[model samples]
Target: MNARALGLLLGYGADRLLGDPQRGHPVAGFGTWALACERQLYAPSRTRGTCFVVVTTAPWVGLAVLATHLPASRTLVTAAFTWAALGGRSLEREALPVHELLFEGELEGARQRIRSLVGRDTSALEAPDLARAVVESLAENQSDAVAATLVWGALAGSPGIVLHRCVNTLDAMVGHRSERYADFGWAAARLDDVLNWLPARVSLLATAAVVGATDGTSAARRVLTGASRDGARHPSPNAGPVEAAAAYALGVQLGGLTTYGDRVEDRGQLGDGRPVSVRDIRRAATLTRQVGLVVLGAAVTATAMGGRLRRR
Candidate 1:
């Protein structure tokens, strides 16, 4: 019932659910539902206008009712489901397949796979571009999927987490500037921007804390300052800080030319480190895991303190 116990349960449950084919992979279900809802609810113009009001309003009302009557175990189960559902497919393992394809000199194959995971073109990308894309995706997703869900779950329980995931899922499915989604995805995009506002900064701070702890306090301070100045330069509002911090912590350069379908987007670079490489991608993953652990620990601690205060 306490935050720490709840956070541990949620975190442990997420790890256990990973690679679980029997449940059809938990994150996949979340993505499926989200995509389905967007296709159904927003694809129609009349419905799209009311999407935000409907989605946000319904969940809080439902959660209020559930909180009043639901048993603790049931609430926890719901929370666990929300965590897995929001994460989508396990990109952590999926990244390895991409690495292997690139490792074998399968440029075409790697590019094809990369298309599914990112909005950019991988066909013309060299090794450094490929590595940068992977690292960027990993860093951004750490805030969007992992850190955001975990923090919401700890603070507000299952329904709160589920609501956050729904916003995120909707954004991913329909939120883009492409002609097909421009109007319909507007609500989802705005909502995602609002939801991610705090979590994004929290994620950057968490990354800085971990880097400082692992490297040194001075290194952490430099990374934080770099992120504060350079993070906003990235196209996404929330992704900049985490990516900037990671680039600084790992001593790698990120951001450059990114090709989308037929257009190329040249983003400003974040860190002053070396160009990306395969080793950098792997190191980024390692750093992601390390930050995840630290965030989990902090969530648990905060939850414990809350329980004590309530008892008093």
Candidate 2:
């Protein structure tokens, strides 16, 4: 298959897998699997830890890809693996539900849900802060979770995608600064950063392109330039552009303080427009959907061109 055809196929496969409730619900299982793999492979020595995690996860990703070559069952396996790797409970869905509680003035319920979704204390968060946190998470995850995964899957096929998922899972599991993973998880964290580096930028550009097409090329240029100038300020190398582009496209501020455990991190903000609100959060989702469609269309066009060339 050509790049575009593969991309379209991958996108359709991902959408179908994500939309299916039975398959989608198992996302947590994938998370659990990744965590389990991390714990099993986590050696005390940094070198040993890195080797163990890489060796273990690589094969699993490869196996997942190989399974895609199977007959009629390949699609089901691919769908299951994708759902497990990428379909789990997201901050986006969780955020809205929590927001609803808060909107009804149920502060305590919102606080509880927020605590569950994020690792930080939410006792002191106001409604706006809660909304901001949700929006930022949604924006960042567009690169980390959705876009990156789809691109990886498209390029590398199922195995490549599975491998990406495994690395991401490892990063999420042990990538944080805590007593347990501070040293050992370093390799996994760095690897995840490296893997996501290009894809993140591509996702930002894709978002910019879509915005420019739907809005104006000037708006897209502004978003891209602003992202390039300011994205590196965020803690993550890959997360900045996605968050920045989303904020710019939606015309709202994102980023700032995020708490983890007892420590509070002051992250650089993206965009200087209005403060984030539920409407903005919804708009971000809409943008994500639009970006997905853009990607799908591009892939389809590319695939068709390739087919024509082959025929010629």
Best by TM-score: 1
Worst 10 residues of 1 by lDDT: 80-89
Estimated TM-score for each candidate: 0.87, 0.85
Candidate 1 lDDT tens digits, 93-114: 6566677787888877877887
* Decoy 2 TM-score against native: 0.85
Residue 170 lDDT in candidate 2 = 76
Candidate 1 Cα misplacement greater than 4 A, ranges? 1-4, 7-10, 16-68, 72-75, 86-89
| Candidate 2 segments whose C-alpha is farther than 4 A from its true place | 1-27, 33-41, 73-84, 88-92, 115-117, 299-312
lDDT of 1 at 127: 71
Enumerate residue pairs that collide in model 1.
none
- Write model 2 residue lDDT over 236-259, tens digit each, in one string: 888887888888888888878887
Best by lDDT: 1
Worst 10 residues of 2 by lDDT: 82-91
Residue pairs in collision within model 2: 65-159
